[model samples]
Target chain A: MLRALRVASPLAVVALWQLASSLGVLDPSTLASPAQLARTAWELTRSGELPHAVAVSARRAALGFALGAAVAIAAGTVVGLSRVGDAVLDPLMQMLRMLPLFGLVPLFIIWFGIQEEPKIYLVALAVVVPLYLNLVAALRGVDRDLVEVARVLRLRRAEAVRHVYLPAVLPGVLVGLRQALGLAWITLIVAEQVNAGAGLGFLVNNARDFLLTDVIVVGLLCYAALGLVTDGVVRALEWRALRWRDGGETA
Target chain B: MTGTDLTTPVVAAAHGVRRAFGDHVVLDGVDLEIRRGEFVTLLGRSGSGKSTLLRIVGGLDQGAEGDVRTGTAPAVVFQDPRLLPWRRVLDNVALGLRGPDARARSTEVLDEVGLAGRERAWPRQLSGGQRQRVALARALVREPDLLLLDEPFSALDALTRISAQQLVRRLVDVHRPAVLMVTHDVEEALLLVDRVVLVDDGRIALDEEVGVRRPRRRDDPDLVRWRTRLLGLLGVADA
Candidate 1:
């Protein structure tokens, strides 16, 4: 069955890898054995190095994401609602969206210096465009008839947004959040690992200099864990927001 | 039906209304009015500008060159229910109106529409007929002096349409909001409205009052005769 193979294949690969390490076919310094990586991870956890690095990375990602998402949502709402706002902000966003954001790492380093500022700004820049684009597209796709219904009811400006536009654009906003969060992690990795700083990426950089293969693998695993956790949080928010799609009153 | 006459206050009126999409005209210098407590239906073929004129009178169309006046914003029940899928029945019904009693009034309207226990239900959970009922409830909750129903029941099944029609008839009688419904169904036009106007060539081809009383059967002699006349006016030769 596919279910069993899905579980067994990864285990088989790990077993083969450990066997190769024991037989000395693989260099322990170049690529750590599964047992060795696990041992180093345990040691780092006890010594508090891994935990401290994770905390620092989490703080940077959270701050950058919060800043980016807030500004993007506000800009998107303005452009989507008013024609005047659309005229000014929409063209600017269209041009900005095409910027190869990851390629700005060097420029960011120059402007913000090789510190938390560069890393955080890199993450922030990477996230803003996609969320803004998705929110604007969602607003454009709202049903014309629904808009007419609002006009017929003569809803006030604020009331129309609350009753019509907010819920209409929510699914798109949530989708954009997931995408932006993934890109945030990838950008953080690039920014931190390439430059001087403290974080998971710094840990990876330090391990490479010392040739500690086990520590490097542990740092990579930490990145994967943080990414999954952030994505899971967004998914939970999505379920709560769109409960009207399937779940009933009792549910 | 409630003694509508020339002296009754007009809830909505449009004079010399003209609208065109580039070279093609949809409504051509049409004039119409709905008196207080009266139900009027515009019967027309597809693309005959019936819906366009309704939209113009309801303030949804601004391209028309005309003098249009109406009381407070008309409550509209569009062909598609147009319920907010994310909003619960209660929230949807309470959409425009404000104040603390909004929810309580919305609940009362929902109950009147036979959706008494569905306040917390999402629009997606309801059947087509139930959703239309919620749309009606939403319109009625506003307590507008003018009500617009744009083919509101046309999308329902035959049996469901009959019940929906009856519900509209019942509500109009109770609330007495000046009503204008657009429908191609001749029988529906005759069965529901105090006056029936036939639209042809982007203009009102025929407008007449129905003398038939309420609680009348579909097979009643007067409605049958009116149905034949209206269908003929709508360009159906053999009815």
Candidate 2:
């Protein structure tokens, strides 16, 4: 019943939107009719333009996200494990984290130019801080008793981390990853819109310039769909990794 | 599972141990010794430092002004069970075993604790007593020379506590570790431990040895007398 409601509610909204546009209660020029938007989406799909644009944006987001997450995990683990690492990195990380990603976009563009590099760099910067912060919090959240048990058992450093720390922090890290994915997708769209060539964001920018409301609507829908797909993938991975936690109530 | 050689003398000792946090003294100038294979209980009121002393002896905390020496690493089971939430029962038990043979040893210990078929269960899925049992198994899997328990059975219900107490007694008899368990319950201390050490005002108030045989009955005359004595020392009347 919940699933059916989810499907029905969206269809109802689309039907109301189409009826309003046809009755001139809503202007089709500013707010495109559902049929007009669908026709434009179909045209873009037929020409293979939409797929290419989507693929470019996805590739950039995927690469940037992977790089950012990897670095975050490594840095977070080091800071989490040692007092010296925490002392050295935490203050600087805090300062960097407070600076907005868009605020650094111009600096990145100045340094890396109008090429794909700046866009990727912007997305990476946008995603890394949240991932790192979440991972660090997760690592610190590990139970002290568990760490003591590892010490009493005489487990080596690597073994202790693998057997005790990693499993404990995984759920928190997944949450951070989900948040970072959303941020990365939003950042990618904005970054691509800024002096970019051929991506979904570029399509949206061009459509806006020409007052092509249907294309703009299509671009926005694509962004939402991409966010949903990425989130779904992350959730699936989390479910697989944390199978042991299924029957247990979360703390 | 053989008895201690009886000639090994003291397996662990604390000399002039004193611990303080700022203005509050938790343990003050305490001395303790545990003979090999002896089951000792440190019984005290909540603020009397029984748990603090146990932590110092277990090497989980450093005392401010004393030396502690133990021949082997001492494994501890806290009052809260403290099982890692993300780990399976077998994996939690396996945390105490190192190197190549850990998995097999974990399985054996789980079996020994009567949780053989529930190795794959998570800690939260288990009842309070069962989680405590897993904690016990983790400690036992290491075959430690010293086992320090800090009010390990205090969280269980009456029947479960009794059964777990019986299980611990049997395991101690078989494994023969020098065990030091901290508890607030005088009856439970008397029922499980061979020697009872009472702590009061950051000092050892009483150290009495129970000379009873294995499978001690709670209603035994000697145990009853000892319980009465211990209650009097704690300034509480038996109900």
Candidate 3:
């Protein structure tokens, strides 16, 4: 019953929207009707424009997220593992973290040029802060008693990391990854808007220029779908990784 | 399992061990010894330093000033189960063991603890008593020369505590590791320990050998007498 309601809620809203469009209660210029949006999506699909744009946006998000997560994990591990590492790098990272990464799009464009580099750089920068912060916090939050267990068990350094620290940090890192994914999508949209592009943002911009509200809506629905899909994948990974956790619920 | 020789050698010996925290001393010039295959209990009040002494013997708190010699690194079962929440029951038991057959060895030990088919379960999936059983299994799987239990059953309910106590006694009889368990319960110390030592004001006040034979009952007159004596030492008036 609850699952049925969840499906019904979205359908109900769409139905109301379609009704409003039919009665002319809503303007066709600003908001596309469900039928119009569907026709537009089908047209773009047949013409191959939507797929091409989707490919471009998906690649950028994937590459940018991987780059950001890699750097953050490395830096977070270093700063978390040793007192000296924490003392050296954490302060500067904290200062950098306070800056709004979205505002750096213009700066990145100037530095790396108005191309793929700037767009990818924006997504990478957007995700790094939360990833690093969560990693550091999780590392520091490892149970002291568990560490003592490792000591008593005579687990060597590598074994301790593999069994103790890695497991301890994983749940927190996965949460951070999900948050970073959200930020990555927002940053990608904004970054794609700043310059001439061959991505979803470019498609939306072209549609807006031609007053193609249906096509613009299709572009946004694609973004929402991609976000949902990626989030679902991460949730599945978390479910498998945290099988030891109670409830056994997927994200 | 290796055959345990009762007269083989001393399992653990602590000589002039002293641990202090600034002005407050925990274990002050304490000396203790355990024979192979013996079950010893340290009974004391809340601040009696029984845990400090256990830590020193376990080689965990090296800040103590003294020497401790043991046949090998002692395995410890803490008050809490202390099993890694992320690992499955079998993995937690196999933590310290090595080699190709560690998984099979862990399975055997888990079964010995009477958790025959719960090897794949997580720590949280088990009850309080079951988790403690896993802790005992983890300690035993390593087959250490000495097993130090710091109030391992203190957190359990009355009925669960009795069953857990029985399990520990049975395991000790079979595996024959020199056991030094610290607890504040007089009845527990009398029921499980071959020898009971009282710690008071950073010293061993009474080290009495309980003359009761194996598998003694709680209502036995000898156990009753020892409980009265220990309670008196702890400043609790006899009922």
Q: Which one wins on DockQ?
A: 1
Give the C-alpha miss distance for residue A203 in model 2, angstroms. Answer: 2.0
Candidate 1 chain B: minimum summed lDDT over ten consecutive residues — where? B230-239
TM-score of each: 0.92, 0.89, 0.93
User: Candidate 1 or 2, higher lDDT?
Assistant: 1
lDDT by residue for model 3 (B1-239), tens = 22334566888988888889998889887888887788888888888898888888778887898878764958999999999998888899999688999999999999999999988888888899999999999999999789999999999999999999999999998998888999988888888888888888889898767888766988888778878888999999878
Kindly list the interface RMSD, in angstroms, of each predicted candidate in the order they appear: 1.9, 4.4, 4.2
Cα displacement (Å) at residue B132, model 2: 0.6
DockQ comparisons of all candidates to the true complex: 0.60, 0.40, 0.46
RMSD vs true structure, all candidates: 2.4, 3.3, 3.1
Q: Give the lDDT of residue A246 in candidate 2.
A: 74
Candidate order by TM-score, highest to lowest? Answer: 3, 1, 2
Off by over 4 Å in 1: A1-12, A19-25, A82-91, A247-251
Model 3: residues with Cα > 4 Å off, grouped in runs: A19-28, A247-251, B1-7
lDDT of 2 by residue, A1-251 (tens): 99999999999999999999999998866899999998999999999999989998898998898788877887888898789999998887788799878878789889999888988887887788989999999999988877877776777898887888888888889999999999999899889877788889889999999989999999999999999999999999998889776774432
lDDT of 3 by residue, A1-251 (tens): 99999999999999999999999998888898999999989989999999999999999999899899888988899999889999999998898898878778778878999778888877888788899999999999999999999999999999999999999989999999999999999989888877756999999998889888898899999999999998999899898889888735321
lDDT of each: 0.88, 0.86, 0.88
lDDT of 2 by residue, B14-106 (tens): 999999998899888899998888889998888999888888888877545798886486888888888877778888888746579899989
Model 3 clashing residue pairs (backbone): none
TM-score, predicted candidate 3 vs. hidden true structure: 0.93
lDDT of 1 by residue, A154-212 (tens): 78988888888888888998899999999999988888878756878889999999999
